[model samples]
Target: MDTTMSADTVVLLTGGTSGIGRVAAERLAATGATVVAVGRDRERGRAVAEEATAESAGTVAFRRVDLADRSAVRDLAAAVDDEYGRLDALVHNAGLASATRRETADGVESTFAVNHLAPYLLTHDLIGALADTPGARVVVTASSVHRRGSLDFDDLGFSSGYDALDAYARSKLANVAFTLELAERLRASDRADGVVANCVHPGFVPSTGLYRDVSRRAKLLTRLAGLVPGVGTSAAKAARRLVEVTAAPEYGERTGLYVGGDGPEEPSEAARDPETRDRLWRVSADLVGVDPDWP
Candidate 1:
């Protein structure tokens, strides 16, 4: 990667135990940025950081965090603030794709809590540091599956009829909407002048552990898709794009854009709904116990 940040640039990435987050962490570290990876598995997290640190001229570390627990997530955010004192980027990449419905420690659905609320709390807490970084960026890893989503705030937990794929899609859709609204607020408040908050669909990359719970039938389908040349991209390639977008000056001062494999794409109808996005921001603030002010 040609892009290089200052030696002091601090990047905090979740879900770096594997997949795109792992690759992105390593790539950023090689570029001379401090990388702090967050995940629940101590062994895997340590291994990832060690490999990155070995390949990097910068510092690489790991912090165990389970985003499903609200209080735990809050504490992790506080720890990050205390340790780093400044955050240049936060990549919300950790997530779970469960075939069964699960609840978080805070009684919220696991998918919702991990995929959305976790980043919400973490980013909310780290806004001060992000704002301090002149060219800070927030990149959310959403998916094309989000196109198949519908927002039913009344049934946010999917109580009546819950399917794992649908729930995951809804969470991703919420990500795009959250990015849009958050970008708007950031620009309006002028807190993040050169900080651009954007979302991206990292196209299908097989063997990412996201399909760990998929049935045999799903696995077969994934294999078949991989057989096709352009159907699935590699984790490394996708992470390269992510790193580029996050570090590029072209994205500076721009916010709320939904980028795809082929560059920016039009977001889903639900994702573009300002009212719904605003409402989600408010609801997420309440869930995370943050004040109403979000920028």
Candidate 2:
């Protein structure tokens, strides 16, 4: 895959301060793309940008964004458009693994808000900028765990009962569903030729910051799992797949594809359900206060 980027190519990446996101940001920057790395921590964001810029041939800029807040996500989209005018690629790599259920300021489940709704809202807000840019791509960091997920629309926030793994898996499933629907929407729009959307499972990288909120026992188990062959991968290795899916010329025209370690793989039955995808899109749009049938 050709890793070089045009001088005008601009990529916006979330959760870029650590894990695969961080590694991918630096790698993309090294390929000469202008990378806007978004995160909630100001200091860590700045440090990641500085380190990536110092080591890469391209430019990396830090943008503070709290994915849990819908309003903040909207502001981020506007800022990106105002600053760059065009977004070549938008990589939704931010994720959360909560040990216990919590609610966001928006009165939504924290895991769902951060993992799924954030990307959904941000992409919706940036649709115009993305459509305006040629060969624009949307890359979401999903998970293989989505296969075990079951989405309960009536209790999306898990008001009745909540399990950390269940919540996380459901959110990952939402990511895949969202991408499938987004691809269809973009394809039906006038700018179909320019914009595309896809999601990927970056492989289980237990060493990443994603497990910080989990229990110590869970963390130890993940570490042990990582040591086993074919169980987990390093953040750096997983990040290469992210870059390939997000920026490589091979995947430029592909939309709604679920990429695993090797290449495009079939997603779970739930994720591939058209009705579920449409319902999730509508519900997500309503929650974020955007038109459900947006271009």
Candidate 3:
């Protein structure tokens, strides 16, 4: 909790305009780390950046990027590389929960594209920047719902029988698998020393806009469910957890790990499978048009 980062340290955080990402951005900025907040809404992004800058000791900048668009994500990475030659942390927290199945311009499912592939591609594109920085970290916002999810490589996009919860859960599962595979690859690549990747389940946060696209009934149900004891945590608390994983010295050497409210916990059986992780990596790379053997 007392971890202090240098002012020169650069953090690229998606979904920083709102919810847990916003809180994390503010908290990290207070630690004197330069925070680059990415989001689709330029207005909100600018407002959050101003607020964070006013309240924090470090600098906070905003960047616009549509996570669902591969080209846009690539452009965002390019811009980040151009501005900051090295990155200290890459936090992926942007995601959506849709009531109905939808496809992106890339012809991939909207939920999968936004939640999983976007982070995969963005991380793949920024690996060099991260590798060059010592002790760089990758923190993915995943979910415990992954425990109830299953992946079918044959139909990863969920072209048929698309259930909202099932799609969201699968995407979360992919988040875990991606983290595991990314940790392994970073170890094998150049400048792997001190570079680590980990995922966190922020618990059920019903107050965020993540479920805005879901039906009213579903939204009501989630709000009701969140009222139960031990069911949900406030967005600020969840964001603090992310800040801990991102800046805490204790987790600096941890990789391919899953951390929840109680600390590091075991992911689902599928999330622990090497073969599944490899397959998911390859498929994700293919979907996003990135090289699987990226450095």
Clashes of each: 0, 0, 0
| Predictions in order: lDDT | 0.84, 0.91, 0.91
- State the lDDT of candidate 1 residue by residue for 29-132, as single tens digits: 88898988888989889898888898788767998988898888878878888888888888888877778898986888889899988988888888888888
- Residue 211's lDDT in candidate 2: 94
Instruction: Report the lDDT tens digits of candidate 2 across residue range 1-295.
Output: 5853666789999999999999999999988889999998888889989998888878889998889988899999999999999999999999999988899998999999999999998888898899888889999999999999988999999899878889999999999999998898888887554798999999999889999998788888988998999898999999999999988888998899999988999999999999999999999988888889877
Query: Which scores higher on TM-score, 1 or 3?
Result: 3
- The stretch of ten residues in a row with the least summed lDDT in candidate 3 is 186-195
Clashing pairs in 3: none
* True lDDT of residue 73, candidate 3: 94
Q: Name the runs in model 2 displaced over 4 angstroms.
A: none
Instruction: In model 3, state the lDDT of residue 70.
Output: 91
**What TM-score does structure 3 among the candidates reach?**
0.97
- State every prediction's TM-score relative to the real structure: 0.96, 0.98, 0.97
